[model samples]
Target: MSVDLPVSSPTWVSAFLDLAAEELERGSAFWAQVTGTTLSAVRGAQHEFTTLVPTDGDDHLRIQRRDAGGSRVHLDLHVPDQAAAAAYAVELGAEVVRPEEREDGFVVLVSPGGLSFCFVGQRATTRSRPTSWPAGHRSRVDQVSIDAPGRLLAAELAFWRDLTGWRLRRTAYPEFHQLEVPSSQPLQVLLQRLDDDATEVSVHLDLTTDDVGAELERHVALGARVLASHDHWTVLADPGGLRYCVAGDPPDHDVPA
Candidate 1:
């Protein structure tokens, strides 16, 4: 497939990139205060950064576990036409998924190399603009840092790189191997390995809800285990034991390994 980025992107792409950068910086600063560790960007990966913060402070976890790859590392593009978007994805060799219905609008999708993304409609007047990320006023946030199970970081990364044509954003270290998306937004998918199935090996989902506690309670009613809870969010392990979370804010926790 001949992958082509649009000659012109929505005005919001630039805006969103700026916002994403800001939020990353802000997140770094916030984490720094909490951990007393310095923040730094990984070399050679534009917009890819990390912090060396302490794990057990500020009621926050002692070690901050973060990487930019996982099932949730998706983007929501607002194209003028959903069908056109799907067709474009097909042109890019992405496998199209059904355009599902949501309360706000419809989601048309295509997963490039099994990485999923949605094309949502501009249904409401007050919709989230991608540029709001840097201002820390984002509407939709997507960053996935997965915990892969084996010594397959290099192989997995090479597969994705061959599949998506996205360049490597960072090298493999004790923790993660990072990939870059064209835009500045939080389009990270992490590959992590867990011990003794501490968390289930499944694609986990994270949602920003009105009330973390209330939503946690609701999921509990539906039979989800409360794995971990903090002031910012509540972690829920699904019946299948996959770990996910709902919170008032984005995931900025640092869990030391």
Candidate 2:
């Protein structure tokens, strides 16, 4: 099936950290400290949703309490028209997992490779701001890296490209490709080709820190443990066992001094 892509429209990309219902309080507290944001009142029929209201910019981050599924991160693409965006995603090879309508007009869809994201009507305003660490810290969740099996990289890349109309660029690393969203957007997404036979798609958040060591220590104090350390980035598992990374400056943002 062929679906024509729509002209790039005003879009806002936000990240949601999903955790088991039991872990919502713990997760919310941890994330609030990590990002220097305060938690808003819990919403949703089951009181399963909350936003980490930032001090400035739009609130581009949220936390959800899920009854099933392991803890992980997902993206919410807010566009002018939710229905049109959802249709465009279906044309690009996504399946609607939940067709239920929300008063806010958002639909949940999964990518060709199984990564779950949503399309929602554009928000009236966002309080998103660049990563500004607390007085002694210089780190924030600024990027999301989507890991796809080698076999699905091409389709996944094309899907995201046509969906966001973001500038696509290759990195020095052969397996890494970037969908560079506008600087005005809060978070950037990177598509990574995994060197494995696995076909499922998963995502991890990336923190851009001026001092990896300091940030690592801070996160460890906040309940994250180091899984691995690399020259440019360090992998750490949150209290709930979700793996994320702490790296140097983001390509699209200025490094804090």
- Highest lDDT: give the candidate number: 2
lDDT tens digits, residue span 1-257, model 2:
55444632436788889988777778789888887889999888777889988787677888999899778888888887777777778888999987638664778899999999987765735434445555454666778999999988888999888888776899988889988766566677889999988868888888887777778888899999899998789999888888899897743353222
Error of 1 at 197 (Å): 7.7
Clashes of each: 34, 6
> Global lDDT of each model?
0.41, 0.80
lDDT: worst 10-residue window of model 2: 248-257
Cα lDDT tens digits, model 1, 182-230, are 4433234444444433322223334454345554555565556888777
State every prediction's TM-score relative to the real structure.
0.35, 0.90
TM-score of 2: 0.90
